[model samples]
Target chain A: MRLRCLALILFSLSSSLARTQPDIANPHSEDTNWLNQYAHGLGEQHTELGLEALQLGDYAKAERSLLDAIQVIKVNQGLYATDQLRPLQYLIEAQLTLGEWHAAETQIEYFQWINVRNYRNSIFTYLNGTEALSGLLLASSANVNNPYSVRHLVAAKNLNWQAVNAIEQTFGSNSLELAPWLYRIVLNHYYQSTMLRRQGLSNYSFKSDSSEIVSGWTMRHNETLEMSYRIGKELLGRIQELFAYHVADHEQISNDATALMTIYQGDWELLFGNDEEALEHYRSAYQDLLQMGRSEAQVDRFFDRPVSLPAPRLQMQWPDQLAAESNEPLQFFAWSPMYPSASRPAEPRGDALAADDQQTALARFDLTPAAEDEPADTILADTNLSLDNLQILGTTPDNELTREQARVYISLLQFRPRLVSGMPVKLENIELEYLFPPQMSLLPLLDP
Target chain B: MIRSVGAYLKIRGTEMFKAIFALLSILLLHACVGSPAQSNAPRLPTDAEVEQYNASVPADEHIVCRDEIPVGTNIPRRKCRYVRDIQQTSTFHREQLRRALQ
Candidate 1:
């Protein structure tokens, strides 16, 4: 009876100890692990709340919350953790909205450092980080308020090169995965060409620290133009080769991809002002599609509308099966003063233009073909738009200055001509809505 | 009057060694004289190659290539130079012109 009473007293003492000092009762219940989990959860909660605040247009609050989340995550997950990347990106978006350019720039460098740490861990993680960083860099470079905009542009292009090398090393030299990255670099070449047209930009350095011109005086004006043309042409050829390799390996692969890439080849040529070559390529693609058993009407429908040159996406189908004509006004959001054809990535989080809360000006005009007369000579010419019958519908704020700006913006735009039966044709009653980048007053518009 | 077989064999061995050494010396000289531009570098680097090489280098050390027509020729030749060298040349020329004006 005494032994039984002693055991009961010991059990009561242990239960009481478990309640007060749980670590003593369960040795595995350390405070560090519990605090880590708590911190991670708190960080996630703050991130979600920050995103919500961003959506609600409270950038200052969003920035504070996202900063808090980043700090919490770094403390718990350890510094340079990839888990903090999403919150870091959102924080950059908030800072961009608040016109915090220097802060945003510094955060971008941190984001890159963290991303580079995870590169060797997994290719998917590397690609995800690169895509996010590239989009963010592009968006920041496009901002009018950014003093170091050109530097950001160069950095994004350089990042593309890094991705290309990584992919080539992981895969092979001619892997199909290289098409988008290579195409992105070609687009950057186009952006750089436009910058060359401006007079004082001759000394524009791609490096952040160096004041020396990127190409120095070795590349004359015309020679620089040729360089862009040659590089873009070679990359387009490489893309075609990648597609051809896949088509050769698999019998079920359609030749449509090759033909669609041919069309992009034409777009690249047109971007470089090689109208004759561009038209020849377009015609060849048209014939190739016809030979592939596509109906004339179907092919014509595919090329019915005018698209901006150097298409935002490298579509690999002769007839875009999912394309549907929309009655909504065509939205032409210029990415930057230098990159007129470049567009924001499909995702909205890293897009600084979307966060800018800028004005949108609606305009109506006739997209008449300037090559109507002597069509053979001027087919796909750079000056395909004559800028006649331009009418400004309205600006968001209903201001005279914005209306005038919209008119000038629309007048400066050039589009790939709509093709009918492989011949460029005129279109009427084209409505366009243009979004003016924030801080537009700071940078001068490029000359027509 | 014939020499011993061992002596004849020794002479032949020395001759063979001399022949091989001369051949190796010629090959080494040829390899040394070959231009890196012809042997190692692509005539005009593809965009990817240029970017890769540039990324592995510093900003001022970046190389730029362009087609140029020599003073007496109409045909264009591809010329490449490091930006640092180009900048130094430009600075030197500028200084010379300034001194001449002074």
Candidate 2:
């Protein structure tokens, strides 16, 4: 009985030991070890080295290191199911700095995919808002309408509303979390306002006869000021966080923080209504540009070029004047009555009269009526006579009358003169009497 | 003493069998676990597998030629012989001739 009891105890002990010692062929062990090593290597001041490379303007090296870190994190996550999102964030920043927009977009998409795949549902709420803001800004800069831009704005608005709901549900109306929610609310309003402005619907009614409409429209203009203040406060908080940890150099981080502040301030002042403040910030940015040894032309091309506004006066006047100048000369003569044969011979007789008597008679004539008819003769005489002859004949009434009548007739002929080649006699006072041809009525065979 | 020795042998044999059974059971449990859990596990492709995969994939999808040839080089012309009969063939042929002359 004693031996059997001992054997039973021993067997139980042996089975427990066997269960505790997992199978040697287990695949998870090797993967876990690899993931640990990869995470350790990547976490060991990789960001510091990458930032240093960036400071030295070794962009290629920085990009390579950052990408390497991102790849390591990706592989590590695949093996161990651990979150390594910081490396991806750094990678995105590096890609942005390098102006690799496509790569940045791809990385952002990957980050979003990872978040969804890992069921980090709350992460999208924050990242979606941030990415949407960034996309909207980028789209505005490029002056392009794209799916990314529209989706981003929509996502941002939705996420912000979700965040608001979350905060309201969790903390109620009086919560300190409302502070961050306010920034998001402000952003949502600003984005809507700007979108409205872009679509030429700036005057739209958000509500009937409410100040909210005006406030909504003005929010885009006011956002720069609000954003500058917000960014400044955020920078201070970030600086305090950085200093509290002593993880990075305070001066360098402060400079970068302040640089971003200046960038936002400059952007606001320039885009909104603070040109003087913007100019100061721009000058400061320009100094940094100079320190970085960037060319003036490049800086100008990137940020400082003047926006082209619609020159209303030029837009209104230039085309009309150009059209007038480009056009065929006015066929004013085409509408005038044809000259009578009696009037043609009268013109030469009037030209033979003396100049002194014509001036005395012109002074007695009514000035306004005479002036109205003056252009009639002047146009005819100007068209036919040498400029010098026209000048001399202009002072004589008889000569002027004959010239005026001739001009009126010439103008009529030039506009739509009857082709009188078929009839040898010179017709006088030719006009369009009716729609149907007079000649067809006189001779019916002429219709064909 | 002989009985005691026999009992010890029997216990030892049973323990070995138990160890083998435990290992097999654990393996079977692992196999019962779905593909998604194992999908996270690392897989090192065998040389033969890799070679087969490479062979199965179209070459042009993976290979990109970016080297610039010197003017009047025959290498580009030689490459033209392998080009597929597509719309780009005539244009490629003309470019090859132009490059060869240049």
Candidate 3:
């Protein structure tokens, strides 16, 4: 009885062990173990193979292997969790290399979701933005073949704009802070804008160049000038403050202020219908450029003149803070030059000032043109001064009034047609030159 | 007395061995069986097969394949009947085999 009981216990134990140790001979049974091992083994194997393929420049094969690894991981693990992300990353690289941009984009979106759920890690966020930008650029360029496809261009522009906004918001606009990234975004935005302009989808408002000009010359205008003068004054004040802050070098600030002043003068002339005055301002700007040893010829070219007139002295006031250090007496001369012709009263009856004398005074010094009576109706009617008949008389060298003849003619048509209708008017011919103080130089002063 | 005692031991030991072996076999077989029946498999047509099928079909009917017909085509009920038959047979065969093995 004891032996039988021992044998019975032993038999049960043997059978239990046999059951636990799965039959290795049965292909079906072995297949379960094989599949488990095969899946895990294949995942690791393909990962290595995919990496090797990528290194070898076999992108298609790399994509297949990487995708296979990812699929296996997905099958084994219900969700593609963090551990499986490595394979997915490889998959993305492979797809990108193969130029499967759409597929890569879809995968990037999935990866972005994973990153969001994990926590908004900076690396993933940056990668997501980069990949999206790349995909958008690709789509935009591809749409060039189909120029009528507005959607692609619009989408590309919006995406690039979003990227720019995101970077700006995250890293303040300080170039030092975001210099490494700013260039690319800026270039992209510039190029995209150019493309959109070419496509006729641009929302460009035709802002008159005279707007900035008008704002700068507020000091010269009496009452007719708009709110621009106050704005200009405020801008000057801010510039002074900026100089105090050492944010800008002195010479740069000076040049910028001078340019603004020149623009203001140009705007004043445009509004007041005084081309001669606008030409004077432009000449002053050219002088400022000359004082800095910059080329003066470009100024003539800019105004379409054979020779540029000399610039007038800028009536720039020193900041009050600098007053204590200066021992020299302050001179508050008018920014404008006192022209001999301008001093003479307008006489409707007297013979007009000699054209030669007027020309000589204008040529020797920066002076304003004298006003004259309107010419007879025959001359006015013969001259193409009508609203329907406007003409751009060729530009004259060193003559601001001549440059603005067209605009003046237009204004005459609109506002003073009667004066121009039958008037035989002789415009005063003046040649002006700009003069700059020796202290004004392009190089900034070194701090003592 | 010894003879009767030995006989009792033998019978008891053999019976226990048989029961354990049967249990083990059943467990192993259960593990060997794979995923459940997949009877709803798609009957994808090959390109050449599709071409031949298309050629034999009448133009008025516009039958691309038995699986796909134009909305207005009055397809014979027998065509769809075959699709149902295929599905039913596959499901029945798999279930019957599973039941027999179990």
Candidate 4:
């Protein structure tokens, strides 16, 4: 009894909704007898008639037959049935050629609505929205009537949003099916920007770094954020495309935490680790100072997992890499691990037999700076090494430090430059910064 | 037994009539509401029509326009404006980051 009442109430509400929703005036001329003839013909006959009229250049007659054919198909095959999509496709081409942007947008939305409905009901899941999105919103006029009754749908208003939402709702959000929609969404926002219209925006064009051809853009709003996001999506697409087929290659290309070259699918952060990762050198310096002299109370001051890399804008707008091509010998301030001299080379006590691929992989990311040519003059004492410290650990029977107590860390380094000095200076004090950590140097540290 | 069978047949017939009427009404309403029309939509292009057009092309690589395309086929507008060309500007991105950190 309760279920019956609920169904009755729901039906009444829907009927009321139908009554209250104003029937948008038919934009096409309704007084014509040819369109009225659509009510009498079968769907197949109408389709045949529409095609014939289309070929004869009688578009008014063609549109009548085609629209009726589509409506009939919607009722028979279900609103979003794969077969119901054909007539709508034909209809949109007509609208596009006629320069009816709003109508084109509306027709596409109807297609999206049906596809979304079908997709929700366990029909084919991945409905491609990109192609429909590409040619939309070209009509200078936003004025148009919604012929198909889409709920809460104003013609050309949020049509891109609706399409994107429907596709996302159908396929999971991360699907590459989203790539073109995001691209289109950003473009639509530019089209709608009030600032661009006031400025008489025309032919703002540029070539993407990856694509060879130039594309024109008009700013609907005055902001580079949309542009940044579009590139971000492109990078994301590239990462997914590469990672699917080549994980090993991607990892090597990414080069672990700080990739000079990044194809981060999600955002700029993936290229570099979170902001804290960018400031790792500073944190390490603080920790090292605590170990040397500072109190334990300061240790808890800095640590976070979900962090952002400070160089987001940097990744978004890269530097002049042509500098690397230049002959300028830039300056640096270096304070890091030094490889030992041959005689002073640290004891190699690790089991030689245990060498394996895992060790080789581990060795790859180790933060060791390669020794420069001037290592001979730069011979320096190991600051941490002490005669008493060595005595505490003692030595093996052969006067050698055991690998357990005395670790001959190859090169645990942190390179920092003297910020005041322009160039030619070596590292002085540690600060918050990110540097492409150098690989292990050939030359080793020697005791003074 | 005969009366019940007749009643069931009557209910099924009524449902069929309603479905047909509803479909026809929707078609009538939808047919009157179209917003645009093309003057000259070609018939579905044959392979020969497409092939003949392609043979007269001048460049090794050229963008095909809408007029040259068939009505039945979908070719999205060639005008693309996706900004932030990473390939052209990423070198700048790498350089700026390096300089900022340095």
Worst 10 residues of 2 chain A by lDDT: A309-318
Per-candidate Cα RMSD to the true structure, in Å, reads 14.1, 43.5, 41.4, 37.8
Off by over 4 Å in 2: A1-39, A54-60, A77-83, A97-99, A114-158, A168-174, A195-448, B1-102
lDDT of all the models against the reference?
A: 0.73, 0.38, 0.39, 0.36
* Winning candidate number (DockQ): 1
Error of 2 at A279 (Å): 28
Question: lDDT tens string, model 1, A1-448?
Answer: 9999999999999987677576555544765355344455879988998999888778999999999899889888888788899999889878876779889878988998888877789887888888778877767766666666677777788888888888988988877778888888887777777666653354334544255444326335775566667878888898888888888895434788888888888888777666677777878888888998888888777887777665777776554473578778888766555454454445444343454467788887766456445433233433444446788988877888667766766676666666667766567677887876555556665444
Per-residue lDDT of candidate 4, residues A57-167 (tens digit): 566676777788887766666655655555665566556545565676678768766655655554333234324333333232221232221111112324433444565
Error of 4 at A128 (Å): 3.9
Assess the local accuracy of residue B86 in candidate 3 as a C-alpha lDDT between 0 and 100. 48
Question: Where in model 1 is the C-alpha error above 4 Å?
Answer: A1-38, A198-200, A206-218, A251-253, A318-329, A334-400, A433-448, B1-42, B88-102
Candidate 2 is scored at a TM of 0.26
Single out the weakest 10-residue window by summed lDDT for candidate 4 chain B. Answer: B58-67
Worst 10 residues of 2 chain B by lDDT: B76-85
lDDT of 1 by residue, B14-56 (tens): 9999999999999887775555476775667654567667765
The order of the candidates by lDDT, greatest first, is 1, 3, 2, 4
Clashes of each: 0, 5, 19, 34
Off by over 4 Å in 4: A1-45, A48-58, A74-82, A99-109, A122-126, A133-174, A180-221, A224-448, B1-102
